[model samples]
Target: MKGNKGLIFLSLMPWLCMEADAAQHWADTSAGVRWSSSFREPYNPEKVSKTILNVTHVSQDDYGRNFLFMDYYISGMEDPSKDNATGAEEFYGLYRRTLSYNALAKDPIDSSWVKDVHLSGRMDVGYENTQLSPRPFKVRMGGLVDFKIPKGSLEWGLEGVYQKSYNGITHRHFEFDPSFVTWMSWNYPVTKKSQFSGILEYLEAIGEDGFGNDTKPLTIFRANYIYDIGQPKGFKVGVGYEQFNNKYSSNNAADPTNGSDQKTFVLLGSYHF
Candidate 1:
C-alpha cells in the first residue's frame, strides 16, 4: 500500500533530523549533505536521482527573523519491491517579524527605497510513499519585501505566500479557494568569493484533491553558483539548477497532475555555524 507507507516514512529520516536538532537549540546553525547524480544526462525518476540531507537554522535578534530546515531524500534507485519512494522527506519553517528592520535602518537615510520589511510565516510538511499523492501539508501566511540593491553583492527578496493545504490518502482535490504563492530570491556577486543564488516561484493550486484530481498552473525554478571556502565559520560550494512545470502532478501515473516538465542538476556543499 503506497510502498508500505513510503517504507515507514523513510525510516524516520534520521530520527526526524535529530528531533529537529533537539528542538532548535543550537541557535544559528547549518549542517549539510548533498550528493546528486545525472552525469551525461539520461537520468530520470520524474526528474531527480537524488541524495540529500540538510539541516539549517538561522536567527536574528529582536524576534524578527528565523528559519529552519530539514530535508532528506534518498532514492537514486531504491527498489524495496517497487513503487520508487514513499514520503522522501521535506520539512520546513519560516518566521519573520522585523517590524521594519529597525525602522528602515533608523530614519530613511536617503530613501533608496525600503530595504527591509517583514511579517512572514510558513510551515511545510511532506512525506511520501506514493500511489499518486502520498502526503502533503502546507501553511503559509506571508508578506516580506526587501529592496535597495546598489552595486554588486546583492541579496534581493520578495514573497507573498498564502497557501493552506493538507491532503493524503491519495487525494484528488476539490477544496477550492486558498492558494497563492509568489516568490523571488537572489544572491548575486560573481566575484569576491563568488556568488549566484536563486529561487523563483509562482503557484496557485486550482483546487481538486479528493479524487476529483486537478492541478495545472505551476512554475518553479532555481539556480546556483556558490564559491567561498574561506572558513572561519563559513564554507560553500555549489552548482545547481532546477526546474519544474506542472500541468498537474499526483505522481503522473497517467494523469495524476499532468506533468509539464522537470529538470535537475546539482553538486553543492555547505558548512555554516
Candidate 2:
C-alpha cells in the first residue's frame, strides 16, 4: 500500500507543479478536513465502531470556453475490532482523478430557461488490509453527467461505475461485476440562514459470482436541514436522517440474513474558510 501510494503521488507531480502557472490563467483551490463515525446495531453487537479522518483538495480552471476541475480525497480509518489481538489496526488509502467540461458556457447564468450541463470521467484505486484478509486491492472506473437549472434551485446527476477486485487471502475471495448509481438532489431556502436538502439514490451490483453473490442492491434516501451557527465566520450545523436497505446472498453461521433495513440519524458541524 505504501509503495502504491508513492507511485500515485509521483504520477501527479507534474500536474501539481503546473498549478503555479495554472493559477494565473484561471483556477481555485481549497482544502478541508472532516471526521465521521458510523454505527450498526445487530451486526455490531458490541457497538463496533470506526473513525475516518479525511482531507480534500479541489481545483477548477477555465481554458478558453471550457472548464476543468480536479478533486482529491485522502482518508484513513481506524477499526476498533481489529485492535484487540495485535493492538494494531489497518489503514486504507484511495486515489481518484476526474476531468470534466461544461456544455453551456455561452449561456448567461441569469438567462430565462437556461441550463448548464457537465460531463466527467473518473478513476479510483484503493488498498486495504483487514483482520480477515492480508491485502486487498480494488479498482473502479466511472463517468457522470451533471445538470444545473438555477431557475428552480435544482441539480441532478447520473453515474455508472464498474469495479474489479483482487483478493490476497485464500478463503476471502472477493469479486463484483459492475454497479450503476443515480441520484437527484434539490436545495431550498426557508430562512435567511437556514436551508433544506433532499436526495434519493439507487445502487446495484449487476451480477452474482464469487463474493459478488453475497452482495445485493441498496436503496438510500436522505434529508437534511442546515442552519448557520455563526453569521460572520461561515460555520453551520446540520441534522439529517438516512435509511438503507441491503441484501446478502447466503447466510453464514456468524450472520444469517438475506436482507436488512436500517435507519440512521446524523449530526454534522462544518466551518468554511
Candidate 3:
C-alpha cells in the first residue's frame, strides 16, 4: 500500500477538481493530543466503554491541507462488550488539494453559495479485535465543496471508497470496489476565541459479515464546541459528542439490517507548536 500511490491517485479521477492558488510550499503545521470516553465503532455490537488517548497532527501547504490522528485504547480489557479491544491502535488521515471556486465556474456567480472546492484523499488503518473494524485499511478520494455563510463555512464532499476484506490477502490490496462515502461539515465563529463545528457522514460498506452477509449504510455524527485558551490561540479545549446510527458490520441486536446505535462523550485538548 505504501508504494501504490499512483493507483490511489488514479482512483481519484472522478472526484478530482481544480487546484488551489497559493505559494508552492508548506504553510502551517501543528500537533496535539486528546482523550475520549465510551467510544463506539462500526464493528462493535455495543459501546466500548473505555478511555483512549489520541495524538494528532495538522499541516497545510500550497497544494492542500492534511490531517493525521493516532488513537490508542486504554481501559477496554475488563469490558467484554467493548468493540475497542485493550491496546488497540487506529490511524486515519486526510489530504486535500484546494480548488478555486471562481476558476471552476468562470461565470462569476453569487459568492454566497459557493466559496471553494478541493480534490481530497483520505485513508484509515486500524488494528482489529472481535469488537471493532476487521479491515486494516480503507482509502477514499473525492472533491469537497465549501459554502460561505455569515460568520462561518459549510463543506460537503463525496468520495469513492476502496476497501479490502479482512481476510482478502496477506496485505490489504486495491479492492477498487466502488463503495460510497460522503460528508457534510460546518464551522462557525462564536466569539473572538471560540467556535462551533460539526460533521456528518454517510458510509456505505462492501464487506461481508458472519454467514457471508452484507451490512447496511451507516450515519456518523460528531460535533464540538472549542475555545482558544491563551494568547495567539496556542492551546485549545473542546467538549464534543459523537454518534453512529449503525455500525459497518451486521451485528445489531434489535435489527441486524440497521446495525446498532452507538454514542460517546469526548473531552479533548490540543496545542500548536
Candidate 4:
C-alpha cells in the first residue's frame, strides 16, 4: 500500500511543477535533479541512497520578493533478493512559499548594505511518509533580519523559525519550538575558473511538548572549492563535510546511550542552463 502511494505521488510531481503557475510574475524559474548515497557505521553498518527532484521560481515586485519551491525524494534500492517487497525505505514531499519586504528600499548610499537590513517573514508546509514514520503535515513560521557591514566584505544575518507537526504517529506528534541560526560567508576568486568560499552556522532549538528531550543545538562549518568546467553556463563541482552534535536531552531510549556524534562528507556536481 505504501509503495503504491509513493509511486503515484512521484508520477504527479513533474506535472505539478510545470503547470502550477498561472501568472508569469517571477524573474526566473529553475529545475534540477540530485542523487546522494551514504554509508555509516554506528555499532551497525548501513547504506542509504536518495534521489531528489526540485523546482524553484522567484519573483521580485514593488512590495517584496516571492518564491515557490517544491521537492520530492525517493530512497532505498530496488532488488528482489534484498527485501525487495518493501520497495523503498522512505519517500517525502515538501512545498513552501515565502514573501519578504525591504524597509530601506529607496536608500542610495550603501544600498546593498542597507537593503539587507529588512524585516522578513515566511511560512512553510511539508508532508513526509517513511518506513520509520507515518505521513504527517508540518508547518513552520519564521522571521529574519539581514545586515552587512560597510567598507568590508563581511556580512551577517539572524533568523528564528518555529515548527509544528500535525496528524502523525504517536512518536511523531506536534511539537512547537523556535530555532536561531547565524551565518557568515566570504567569496574569493582564485583565478577565473576557480573560486573558494567558506561558511559557518550556529543553530539552537528550544524544546516544546514531550518531544523537548530529543531536541539539540548544533553548529556546522563548511568550505567549498568550485571550478568552472568551460563555458559561462557550464558545470561545477564542490566538496564539503558536516559534523553534528546533540545539545538537548533525548526522548528516544536508544539514542541516549549512543550519543549524537555524526558526520558526513559531501560531493556535488551541477550544471547551469
- How would you encode candidate 3's per-residue C-alpha lDDT over 167-197 as one tens digit per residue? 3223333243468898999988899898889
> Distance (Å) between predicted and true CA of 155, model 2?
2.6
Q: By summed lDDT, which 10 consecutive residues of candidate 1 come out lowest? A: 39-48
Task: Indicate the worst ten consecutive residues by lDDT in candidate 4.
Answer: 39-48
**Clash-forming residue pairs, model 4:** 116-146, 213-249
Q: 116-149, model 4: which lDDT tens digit per residue? A: 4333344455544533243433333343444444
Q: Write the per-residue lDDT of candidate 2 for residues 1-273, one digit (tens) a residue.
A: 467557545754544444344434333222222223443322333322333333333345441112232222222332322334332233444443333334225643443443444443334544444444333343333434344454335645566655444544345544455577766766778687888888887766446534444565666787888788777236777787766665221222334431245466766555544
- Residue pairs that clash (backbone atoms under 3 angstroms), model 3: none
What ranges in model 3 sit over 4 Å off?
1-6, 9-28, 41-47, 79-87, 93-110, 129-135, 167-177, 249-259
lDDT of 1 by residue, 1-273 (tens): 366336445643443443344423235677776666531111123433556778787655443455677776664443111254442333344333223454335553345775666655555655544333334445455566666676432333444333334445544432334567777777778788877888787777656645665655567788888887896378787789877666333323344323356566888888888
Q: lDDT (0-100) at residue 231 of candidate 3?
A: 55
TM for every model, in the order presented, reads 0.29, 0.60, 0.73, 0.59
